[model samples]
Target: MQQPPPPIFPIFRSRITCAVLTHTYVGDKEHSITALAAATGTDSGTMAREVSRLERAGILASRHVGRTKLVRANHAAPFYGPLRDLVTIILGPAQVLSEELADVEGIEEAAIFGSWAARIHGESGPTPVDIDLLIIGRPDRDDLYDAAARAKSRLGREVNAVVVTRSRWEANKDGFIRELHSRPVVAVPLPHGNAA
Candidate 1:
């Protein structure tokens, strides 16, 4: 399943599109309600109920695959483009970047630190123009650069990725690492794994 970077909007504000677009942009083409729930940080029961509502509104469509039902975005819906743009362009980079990086082999752990993180943590400042990432592990530098480039293009913001060896990260020896840990840090989950 495609993993969406977490939504920036209050979950309650855009819960419907948050759930649907996470599936549309970052999710697998079709997601079981349970998977969608987990992806959107919503409980399974709530996701099911919301999906039912979207289906009624024609924003999403579902089909039965045996006893399980899979839901996906209905591109044919009139609001699809606008809604997708809202998530993909305005409110989706963090979610998308986190999800995309999670799939990169050798990227064991990742976190966001900097202005974006500060804003999320309720610090006031000029809007952040870039996302600062602290990546832990020995991922291919070229691959990491490529991913950051793509994300930058898509989000219209810089994605600065800093790599640190696991040993250094664990030891907390570097002053930069120490300072980073002191700030707001939002952990990004690795694929099929807990937040790292």
Candidate 2:
């Protein structure tokens, strides 16, 4: 007889674990399981089941508040610190890239922007797209282009970069792109800061 496939709840649990760890602080503060389910694109029932599983594993704490059940991170959880550290380390490259670009003459600041920034901020889903950079500078046109090309070569991935003069960035400070340009960052260094 053919065996039925393993329940889909476990798959949802695993996916939610990564998403929540990467996007939420998960300590003391309460979070709605429904919201978490929406964030992870999983159904509420599956999220509730997985939440119970995680609770048993000491990764989460749950309580009923009014008509809603609020779930939160248990600071006493063994994997809390390690999971947080993992997310930081994984996101560090974007910061390193920003710092590297900031070193170029005429560049004032550089940041991972657009969809990449949204993903980092937990406002959107991850995409298999090139990293987008918002660079503030007034370098010579050739220098700007060359810098981006070199960054792509050194990083082993194509960087979709947009370079704007400091003045332009300042003038358009309220714009969406400018907002992304100033978002929070993570830093990562090359094997040695080498352009190779």
Model 2 per-residue lDDT tens digits across residues 98-145: 444544556555566655555555453555255677666554556656
Q: What TM-score would each prediction reach against the true structure?
A: 0.74, 0.42
lDDT of each: 0.72, 0.56
lDDT top scorer: 1
User: 125-184 in candidate 1: lDDT tens per residue?
Assistant: 776778888888888888888888887876778899999988998898789989987898
Local error of candidate 2 at 178, Å?
19
Off by over 4 Å in 1: 1-20, 98-105, 118-127, 191-196
Error of 2 at 17 (Å): 2.2
RMSD of each: 5.2, 12.4
Error of 2 at 110 (Å): 12
